[model samples]
Target: MSVTTRVYVARLAGTAVFDPIGDQVGRVRDVVVLVRAKGAPRAVGLVVEVPGRRRVFLPLTRVTSIDQGQVISTGLVNMRRFEQRAMETLVLGELLDRTVRFVDGSGEAVVEDVSMARQRTGDWLVDQLFVRRRPQRVTTLSLRRRGATLTVPVEAVTGLAATTRTQGAARLLEAYEDLRPADLADVLHELGESRRLEVATALDNERLADVLEELPTDDQVEILSGLDRDRAADVLEAMQPDDAADLLHELSDEQTAQLLELMEPEEARDVRRLLEYEDYTAGGLMTTEPVILGPETTIATALAQIRRQDLPPALASMVFVCRPPLETPTGRFLGVAHFQRLLREPPHASVGSILDSDTEPLTPDATLGRVTRLLAAYNLLALPVLDAEKRLLGAVSVDDVLDHILPEDWRESHDERLDEEASRG
Candidate 1:
């Protein structure tokens, strides 16, 4: 590969990787390096995430160019999945944000980025680190500058090898800020257990709740357990009632009750109600927080509510029209007003005027099989679950139904299996 004099590894993240013929293969997720006992780490390969979210190793030898915005390869790529080895370190994932001190004992700095340079023998090595100096304590009232960022030879820093020191995740989190919750969960799943918990703890409650919902049940429980009880309860309150209930199901009854007790009364009540249902039933797969509007709500108001960026696509697909009480277990169920219908109607029209009442709503006791079939038969994204009294209890989204029907370990195994099969082919 034609290497530039120096390339900042962090800047290469998410850059497209292409084959010799110019066909894009995947994107760079991280850099793999072999840390040596006495010198800079040797640049081994790139962690490229291909289609289906399978990350594979692309050795540096196969890379033809590492130009701006893209990395061109020799077209021979291994389709097998990448798994980290014992002696390897992921520069972007592990090194960034590490607390280190200069050899001269001036002060400590946080590793912001690392640069790889071609050696005399033609091998690329991580030779320099871009770091931000930690602010020094000041006793005077005079204004002092914040920590300044600068590049220094990697050998000048200490503490990078110490696993005991607490590492900050700010730089890493900033690098992945654009990733979707599911993608971020995938990234988190690949980290070591301790590191995973560290990053999870760094995220705010709402962001962490979104990521937790996308993670496997085991990961969700582990990260939640790592947090203090109060914060854990707050995160649970932020998650969708059904998802929070599912995660709680994996914990001990005592632990679940404690967290529930700490949650807001109304939020905990919804989760507790969901926990009462059998796992394979519609009630267990539904979220109690779908958009609900009374009969007199106007099309414009309904449109505004559904336009909320926080609503999941399936839950946002339609608004459940009900009577007086709009919350779950709402007063008498009217029907649903699909988003498309609202867009077609005048802003002044009431949602009740254009309801899709023909489609029957499922009872909470309905089987998963029944819910799946009804969704497929109606080509619906979400279906409302009603009580025998015809009050809307919650909405069963298609995504939730799929999550239940899939194998329990599907999140952990699905992509790996796909990559294995591709390699065999």
Candidate 2:
């Protein structure tokens, strides 16, 4: 239960897979970590099985020790999987290290991570789990850091823990299992601010970016306040410019000035540009991170660079031909083409050939009404914003526009409003 102590110890990776070990058996299917809790983190436990492989269960009992990041099962399962399947029922911390599945009265999903909770009598229960994607929401939660496009319920999970190893390369990938931004937002709301700071400080930068994007503006401010100005700036800096500006707009000017001063000058200038736009307009709302190209660059070279840099989903979909300025693009715009079109069409084809000249881009100062209409008419997720000389300024995604205009609770509360209007009519 010690926050700083090693919950589970392992050698392969820096930390343990499960705190109490006995329940991890049958080649550990998963380790579920409930990352949405707003209070002290609350997690669950699970295990998975295939056609010939029978599942194992790690009850709250049997797990006695946690070291590093792996659970030590002194109960029935022993420590790690050793190609043994002889059924041995245990009594005490007897479940220690034994592979076990949760009989949730429902079926089992993969377990992701395990956490310890004290019961009324001061005994610990192996209570929390981080599961894999057998449930759809778990997949969305898992990709939170990857910037996937789907929104998950964060509510389908009922049962999970850290008794099993996750897939390759995602060693610490337990938290996002079935986690929802709204649920995480609620947890941030519940943590009474201080705890929120504590958790955010401990998370990695990429994780902080994901969680910050999910949090309400108020929680975002509180968490930022707890961090050193540089670290806070770093978190915001990692965000897409538009998303970072969304949070900055919520802060006092004094706070805003302090945060901007703390950021890298180039990054600060880019974010500042977006901030100067009206809070809801396309110019104000577009991501400055575009897939820009110099007039002299070849389609082949542009394609290579595009594959290398992480692109905004919009620009990746629509390749804009222009020169790169400090943070913005320059030169007269040559319109853009779908990247796929460029690839399928030919490598030697000039960007001029691929350009879709008919779709007129908006200026950075374009109104939301104009931007929204453009999105609808073009049936596009995003559009390029041009400056006075028809230079590519930035691009706005439809998702960004919706976020700028809608209430955060729109998803949860929209249904009730519809019902009320029906009743009124």
Candidate 3:
């Protein structure tokens, strides 16, 4: 086995990034990892803040050495602007300073820092954590003694959860950081009523939106009901319109209208459009944020755009081409260019020239069954959904389709499997 180097994720923040030749490049802003359903997530890259320029992604492959408050890299760095996607997890922004549960279910503790390492596999793992335990109850007998800080292995963390239900509980909810939103939602579903509300109340809008999408309609409504009107509106705004609309469709008109009225007009408008469609229709399943491009764009420029956005692997596999005004209900839908085709072509090749226009796009009103069949027939990961005027609206990904087709109790069954694995471990 190869040697490993221990490093704290927090200490790396603000450390200088240097080229192999000893020239300074930037400061580390955050560490990016691909969160998995289990096991430690591999650190894929770093978000570095370059002086006078936008933050950029520095992939781990480019990093030659990391020590002494500096990260040294030997490879040519891509200066493309960095943007987080659905799959990239920010350690400092989302994980550090959060609370986690002990493996033995003894009590909760605040995470002071994450201990990561470059392992024998040549990957960075969140190997350990520095945590400060919370006192069970404040008493005169323990007044002089505060919670003690201890180094604990990541494996000792059972879940990201908490017994305390304060407004600050959200910070404690990070104990479930190892889990994906779907898995976390399942855990939330299984918890006792008060504990469930405490955890739900703690999650910020974005995280809550992710968890809500994975929850059943009834569960979604229950969680939303626990939050104040403003928070409920914010969470709904953070959710994808189709998912938000579906959840809203399950609520009483009075409740739905109240939340909508509290939301920003622009966001509420999008949800309203989705609500107009039947729950099983194409319009109801599509996400408005597909990678859209003009016909005249070159392969090189397209690749840069893809890197800049850091799209989820599946959505990044292809690019949609459209006419001017590249927004939803955009100018007429043109065609699509696969990433593989882009690679095979000259860097200067125009996307229009390589467009695959043979595939039939789905209309917004297409039934779920029809959408599924078309995606399966073409072996497409995502299909464009258009309007009557042939304007591009959104793209329905295969994952979304699978979400609808799965059994109602799928999340529960998956949760049970996860629980069994935890027991074995």
Using alpha carbons, what is the TM-score of model 1?
Answer: 0.94
The residue-by-residue lDDT of candidate 3 on 1-425, one tens digit each, is 22238878777777888887899999777788776767876778887866543356888877888877788876476665565666776676555555678879888777777778887768888878888788878788666786899999887875432223332343335444555676567556644455566677778788889899888776888889888999999999998777788889988999999999999998998888888877788999887777899999999998877675325455777889999898787899988898888989999989999999987899988999999999999988889988889899888888888889998766544433323323100
Candidate 3 matches the true fold with a TM-score of: 0.59
Error of 3 at 119 (Å): 35
Candidate 1, residues 113-132: lDDT per residue as tens digits?
Answer: 99998777768899999999
Write down the lDDT that model 1 would get. 0.89
Candidate 2 lDDT over residue span 147-193, tens digit each: 22221122433321122222121222233233344444433443324
Best to worst by lDDT, what's the order? 1, 3, 2
Local distance difference test values of all predictions, in order: 0.89, 0.55, 0.77
| Prediction 3 global C-alpha lDDT | 0.77
Question: In model 2, which runs have C-alpha deviations exceeding 4 angstroms?
Answer: 1-192, 323-329, 411-425
Which order, best to worst by TM-score?
Answer: 1, 3, 2
Of the two candidates 1 and 3, the one with more favorable TM-score, higher being better, is: 1
